[model samples]
Target: MEIYRAVVARVRPLTASMIRVTLTGGDLPAFTSTGVGDEYVRLFFPHGPDRHDLSLPVPTESGWETPEGRPTAPMRTYTIRAVRPEPGEIDIDFVVHEHGVAAGWAAAAQPGDPIGLNAPTGLYDPPEDVVRQILVADLTGLPAVARILENTPEHIATRVILEVPDKASEQALPAHPRARVTWTHGGNGHSPSRLAELVTTALPGESDLTGTYLWTAGETTALRSVRKHLRRTLGLDSSRFKVVGYWVPGSDTWTERWEALPATVRAELEALWEAPTDDLEDVTIVYEDRLSNLGL
Candidate 1:
């Protein structure tokens, strides 16, 4: 939960839908990367009408805290696109859109602009014996997918499935001798997503799943369906695959609904959140079911 302050060192647009911002200085000298491909960090920026009043949160033993009367900073999660330890630089690739807190900031970011980031956490972990890897994502998850491909062992064969809004959103990904890529146009907020269907269909037969690892990330609702298929239908173990939700279609509305819940009902959900559990998948399923039951 430590917050490391930094300043924008460079800014470059990688594609029509993606922008890369490089950060350096401040506590970056102490920042450490998990060295995992799908690692990500939370970024905090000034929250105001103009968004020029840069106010960062204070790190605490339990988490981070904002001073009383100070507006909570706008925060967004982003993949660690690349990191150069020697120069203490970190690159975060942001998905550009017409409207979004992070996208707006990244679109106008300039060198020496102050920003705050926390330690990174990663989810992609292929078994040592993994023979084949399947990576699936939309544009929002493209940065992590690209990093995953770059980190894959040369001996392992990889299959990449990407869904982008259009041809303009597509960019050259890292090349691998044994890698194959399949791109599908449409479904990056411009149209209905077919990521789940595409991934499930592109997958090899059940008999071919042995020694295979699957990793996917994209819109929350889409990935939820994919998770169900992989777990219940395919009976894949958590060790064999990783699925993540990058964004939600109407997150602002979701947040408002959450805040409007009765105090007692909210307390019940908070208790569930505090309940200790070792099985993440089971816990997630239960939480989602509870949310649905409560009409959330």
Candidate 2:
């Protein structure tokens, strides 16, 4: 858990509810990421009233150590939307909402703003024998889902199900000739049952799942039920699924919840942080929609 300091280099609105922030600085040379799709980092955002301080517990051999008098910053987990180490930059796509630590920080971020971040870790790698896959996400987990979709082998069949409040919130996803995307507006200004139903109806049957992978994120209850259905009802093996509860609806203690994420997944991330393998050269990310933050 090495702490790295970064200064905001660029901030661009990607959609009605998402903003892409590029962080770069001299201090970022030490930041090395495996560039694995679905990798994330713990962001120690400025907290309290001013949102100006970068104070937080420093990582040590034993664990994080809080200074005697400094106020610990609020922490949030965000997918490493993209990485380009040659230029010493990392992109983080944040869902801009009215509240929450990362949301507020992203809403107000500007160039030269300082931010603290640590641990670029990941748990997703397209299974070697995967015949096909299904990806699902909402605004919060869109970054991770997009990363996976973009990197998936194009020869394999894949489907993506995305839920947003409205058409304006739809961010253009990566293009893969063999992949298809289904966009559904999250009815009633929420993303839950409707998206889950789409997922349920679209999944491959048990006979066809032997060489498949199921990856889903976003609202906890929805995906939790999705996972349960895949495992219990469809008789898919647990090893064939990667389900992450990106956020529980209306959760205020998000940081605390993230810290307690599934132990197996946390272990996977910890192992990656310890010994990240895949080395990728300078990579560039492109988005089709150069849209503004037009609210629904």
Candidate 3:
């Protein structure tokens, strides 16, 4: 992925925990992002006492330089909330809290703040052969689910189970896809495990699970539980589904653990991640049309 510097054009609160920051600059036009979901991007925040220029370290022939005189900045991974390709604009949503550099920057972000961003190199959509789709996630995974629903066919049988802190955090999804959406509230600062239980119990019957594609992201333990249930009980192939750990409790960096299965299972998963030519064409068309209609 190529790195590009983008400035904050605007920032708005989507909910108590979510903040939407619109980024725009001449550098942004060079980024070619397909769409939103769980596509990975790198965000470089300013460092130093003044919090002005980027704080990245200078590279040396031997390796990276030492701590002294090295500008130390915080780097974070985030999802693309929305993208307007023609206008060279992209929206990133951050979950704000009391700690961490990314959250701190987001809380204080204002118009014209200079930030650095890296372009996305891959798409996160499931394979075209997938007959049914199961989406399991929390607030962090919501944007990805919404993107999939918007891009996929309306007749597809898609089931979504999302866990949020409360009803107020719930978002109205786009209208392109027909989905059976379920919400579970993690009440009063309770651990996300409570919500995971609700997700497991809500899984469809085994017969309905065959040939389905599953994508989940949220708390590490909770996501693991759902992954285990789908593999052990439903007898579904691992390669046909995936569970990504978006954030781990008590940690600032994101760590992802993919469930390792047999060689056959790995092959199946590889195939699913690769997009078909037809699907790629369709995505381009949909994205172009959406852009034109929005007058962006």
Candidate 4:
């Protein structure tokens, strides 16, 4: 994968737990992002007093290598919330939480500060001929969900189920052609499972799922439950459904469960990722809610 050295061009608060940062630099040229939901990027932030160190290596031999006894820097995974190529800008939405390096950096990011970015090497597109699209996710997966909603064809019926911490995070989604939007807020410190249950019950009737493409992403357990319900209970074709565990509760990264998926399933996903057709004729846009950019 190509690593880009980007400068913090802009930062804004989106919510108490989310921040929006726009980046620009020469590294962005190779980042030919197709649209929302089609890609994801990684953000690498500095650690400790070395925040001013712009001499870090580009993972190549010539760059400054890690000090013999120094600790590793902070890094996080985030979605490309928006991309503007005309001026060479890319926006990333980060969920701010305590003790996270990316969050800490975002909370205090300023223009001219240097950061590391890795270009997307994979794509997550559904089969172009699919008749319908079902998008499901939590805040972590919102950026991808929103992008898919914005770029999907109008004639292809789309349904989105987004679960947030509460009603306050429920922002308006970009209106897409022939799409139904559903926003579910988990109130009063409820668990992620609560959100999953709500989504399971609120899902459209079985009739709406035929010939539909299902995409589910969120906390690992929640994603697993939904995956079971859709494939086992509903008897949906496994080839048409995808469940991505963006993160796990009490864990810092995506689990290996995804890597252990059956070879058949993985092969199907690879096919979707490699598909080259743009069958959608129109794009739909939607937002759940806005939050203060915690600068992270």
Q: Name the top TM-score candidate.
A: 1
What range of 10 consecutive residues in model 4 has the weakest lDDT sum?
282-291
RMSD to truth, every model: 2.1, 10.3, 11.5, 9.8
Candidate 2 segments exceeding 4 Å error: 187-192, 204-207, 253-296
In candidate 4, what are the lDDT values of residues 1-296, reduced to their tens digit? 45678888989887775788899875776677756474776666776666666433345544334455655556667778788887888888877766557767888889878887766633555766788877877888787887778878788888787888777676667788688888777621255345457556745446566567877777755554565566556766556776676775545432355465667755754555355644211110000000011110
Q: Model 1 clash tally?
A: 0
Encode model 2's per-residue lDDT on 91-170: one tens digit a residue: 99988777778888888888888888887888676668898988877777788878888888778888888887789988
TM-score of 2: 0.81
Q: Choose 1 or 3, whichever is better by lDDT.
A: 1
Q: For residues 1-296, what per-residue lDDT tens digits would candidate 3 score against the true structure?
A: 45677889899998886888999994898888855466768788897545557764434565333258766567888878778877778888887678878888888888888787766733455666777777877887787777777777776778888888888788888775458888878732345355456556666554565556877777654455565566666765556666676776646332222233445644654555376653333333343343234332
TM-score winner, 1 or 4: 1
Clashing pairs in 3: 37-144
Per-structure clash totals for the candidates = 0, 0, 1, 25
Candidate 1 vs. true structure, TM-score = 0.92
The lDDT of each candidate is: 0.86, 0.74, 0.68, 0.66
> Can you tell me which runs of candidate 3 are displaced by over 4 Å?
56-69, 121-123, 187-190, 252-296
Write the candidate numbers in order of decreasing lDDT: 1, 2, 3, 4
Per-candidate TM vs. native?
A: 0.92, 0.81, 0.75, 0.74
In model 1, what lDDT does residue 98 have? Answer: 82
